[model samples]
Target: MKGLGPQIPTKAPPKQSPHFRLYARKYAKSNAWTLKVKNPEHSHDSIENIMVHPAFRKFNEQETSQTAQMSESLLMPRKIWAQLCSQRESDRPVILQYIYNQIKKVKKDKVQGRRPIDALIDTFKEENFVWSSERDA
Candidate 1:
């Protein structure tokens, strides 16, 4: 008589270990932890686990939206300014007027109360390009 051989049970593998589930739940409850604490923002998220811990879900959404908007506002102007400032002297005059215009626009849009001349002076000084009439002897 063939005995009730190999008991067959229908069940899926446990999705997560009990220890991991507990740790995840605890991690999702802490808020003051920095992004570098165990889970950085750039860390890869697994499909089996939630991408963002519960504590950071709302904050992450707000931060993402604000960052996108800020990037849009600063992207083009910053690129143009950086490119112009990095060019050689002989290649700069053509873009000088464009850079000057962008500086004015940034000041106006940001309401920073800085004059274009002052900004140009600061940029030149920061780049170590301040002009002097002294000639090499």
Candidate 2:
């Protein structure tokens, strides 16, 4: 039972970017089912684990009950999976390209920690996004 360093207040994530809302409306007829209960084909099991990485598990460590912690674990992974799935119905190819570029910067700078973006890029690749070297025209 010990307190960690100076506790920083956490902020709720902002609403989805305006672009996602507009994009969703355009694709709603086709992509709306992703908002349902089933796991979309794109979410690889290993990649989803990144959301619960040890670096982040502490955020849920103080949950008052096991149910709260369980829901916390399930909700974040599902939300991220659904967002990426729906994103694919639009310009996902371009988004994956953008994510690949960010990954390069992280590697070039020798970033010490495993960042959230790194996990995202890895998941995208696992979901079949080809890297530039292997990309086809």
Residues 1-137 of candidate 1: C-alpha lDDT, one tens digit per residue:
24768756679777443322112323556554333234233334465644334432222343334334444466564565454445434321323344445445545654357766666666678899957444368
How many clashes (backbone atoms < 3 Å, residues ≥3 apart in a chain or on different chains) does model 1 have? 0
TM-score result, candidate 1: 0.20
RMSD of 1: 22.3
lDDT, candidate 2, equals 0.42
Clash pairs detected, candidate 2: none
| Model 1 lDDT on a 0 to 1 scale | 0.46
lDDT for residue 27 in candidate 1, whole number 0-100: 52
Which runs in model 2 stand beyond 4 Å of their true positions? 1-73, 76-112, 129-137
Q: Choose the strongest candidate by TM-score.
A: 1
- lDDT tens digits, residues 7-38, model 2? 66689776443222211233556654333333
Q: Which stretches of candidate 1 lie over 4 Å from their true place?
A: 1-111, 132-137
TM-score of each model, in listed order: 0.20, 0.17
| lDDT values, one for every candidate | 0.46, 0.42
